[model samples]
Target: MPAKRRPRRPADDSLAANLRFFAILMIAAILLRSLVAAPFSIPSESMLPRLLVGDYLFVAKWPYGWSRHSFPFSLAPIDGRIGGAVPARGDVIVFKTPGDNRTDYIKRLIGLPGDQVQIRGGRLILNGEPVPKLRVADFLDPVSPNSPCRPVPGLRIRLARAADGGAVCRYPRYRETLPGGRSYDVLDIGTTPADDTPVFVVPEDHYFLMGDNRDRSADSRFPAEPGGGIGYVPAENLVGRAMVTFFSTDGSAGWLMPWTWPGATRWNRIGEGF
Candidate 1:
């Protein structure tokens, strides 16, 4: 005799099956975002000349290993960190501020654990040797709604006209080479109190970070306080290393105007890698 066919599932059972499928998809997405890479948007010019406000980039999470901070809300069950590795000097990284331990701050890693870092006369001194700084052409930052070209506090504002007659902000930019020969641009607007500071020995399990925009950044040179400087961030607070810029805008696009979106996109900045 032929076997009997099974009864068809009810409509409610079918709906529950669909919901379960979606739940699995949500869990997969969360794991991917936490373990692989995640998108981050630049909100400040602290990393200017490389990263600009309105630029959206991918931050690779696996580079520095996995910690509670690597996951959303720092709720991951991991203790300390797993498979952690020391980041190279000059690697731009995103981490939680040691102050609040919740706010995200992105900066370049400068001093490793036990390394001494200081600023003298607007120059970076690492391990008692001055890092090479060469004068470069002024960075012509385009004036946009995102970048208003407003002068940094206590500095003079300089503006220029682009080839198309658009307003641009002229900044005194320089190229700084770290100890390991990693080179990047920096903006030194003028003399500031941070121009000179006592050497700070990076504590074990901590890293010293600074912004590429030297004069305007409140980094390890200042005390850890809410809404301000981030002092020697703990390694466990590391989130990820900036990988590449995927999207960018000039902050001129209105949600109501779909036609303006394409025009506002920063085409040249897309696909740029660190």
Candidate 2:
């Protein structure tokens, strides 16, 4: 009897097997970054003190559920894939800008759907009630060549004892009490153009946002006028909630010189949960 020939696997079968393995890995990475956590960088000081420029943060996507904004692109071409719970007040959220979906914004949720939000005499009023505010400290504007010439008012000089027992001139601190009793720090710049803005009622399905920096940030208080900020943002624009800071650097420092790395890196902010 002739020897039986051994069976052979087709080349197409080998190629298909490899492709399937690659596809699985890609899908797993996407799901992990989209549903669990992702990294975000702070490009501006809108949420200063709490978040600083150059601070790299980790945003949690599952806390409030996933929206169309949660996908790789702001718009969900395939619907019903991801959905999230309604965002709550006092939560620090990251979202796409209303008009331009390409831009991302991070702000504390001051108003929710159907809530009336307004800033009167520099105090936040929600649902026709004044949110309690207590002065904290003065905020000093860092010297920069391109910085504005405007000076912040109501800034009281205070002595802040440093770690080495040296005192520095610092502004007072303030606490903002939300309706649900959530309070956070706010810089007391006294009064600015943003303090006397008109009252705005948050439309249904939309939200009101304000920057922690108050006077310096261009947020929902003053849309993009000559020198204004973004106005109220819709719920659909929310991307995720800021969870914690993973890395940070002082804006004044640069990474050009290797010798400057030690001083430039904000080691204390590392591993600090926001």
Candidate 3:
């Protein structure tokens, strides 16, 4: 005898369909984040001026080629195989902190592999040639407006008119030209601790990095002292290059509840290319 016809359950079918859709969505997101660009928020002012504290920037994973550091969670077991082209000097890159590989750091690459780098008399010298540095303005900490931190005693502050017709205060913008004619901005907090120091020759397969906010950044200059920076970083620790700022918000502005998102968002910085 034929058994009773089984009934198709709508609820079971719907659940299975929903699970498949969610799974697909999650996989797509993972793939996009892993292969394409991903957004990273600046947690510290170490990269200041170039990348503010609340700025969210996009890091291009393919520019320097993929390394274990390029993968999501930085879980590639193999070490240093994917660097196709060596990172150029003056490129702003994100890398793993040398002292602790677990921590990620972002800084401008000053010394390339096999390059001589030193700080003498508040100037950067690459391979015995002094990189030109011109003081442009003074930098003030917007987060702490009334803080005592100001431009160095000798240096002067320069206020530039923004495109929006508003005045923005900044510490002198110095044109620091590298040995290869790569020039970028540098900030001098007038005779800070890092201004005068000994010379360091960058070893092979390693690089010297520093923050745009020279006086405030703990970079290759300091070496794990009570309040120092981690030394030179190896090529294996490099993650990617920071390309542009995708989002930014004023750190002082935040919502107490869910209703304040519209007000808290920094509209000006949205879609603003770096």
Predictions in order: lDDT:
0.91, 0.73, 0.73
Identify the leading candidate in terms of lDDT.
1
Q: How many angstroms is residue 249 displaced in model 2 relative to the true structure, after the best TM-score fit? A: 1.6
lDDT tens readout by residue for model 2, 159-211: 45555664444545688988777888876556777887677888887788888
lDDT of 1 by residue, 1-274 (tens): 9999888779878999999999999999899999999999999988888889999999999989999998889998888789857899999999999889899889999999999999999999999999999999999988988888987666745887999999999898999998768999999899989999999999999999999988778788888888899988888999999999999999999979999999889999999999
Model 1 stretches astray by more than 4 angstroms: 1-9, 152-156
Inter-residue clash pairs, candidate 1: none
What is candidate 1's TM-score against the reference?
A: 0.95
2 against 3, candidate with superior TM-score: 3
Weakest ten-residue segment in model 2 by summed lDDT: 141-150
Instruction: Name the TM-score of candidate 2.
Output: 0.78
Deviation (Å) of 243 in candidate 2 = 0.5
Shift in Å, residue 208, candidate 3: 1.0
Q: Alpha-carbon error at 54 in model 3, in Å?
A: 0.8
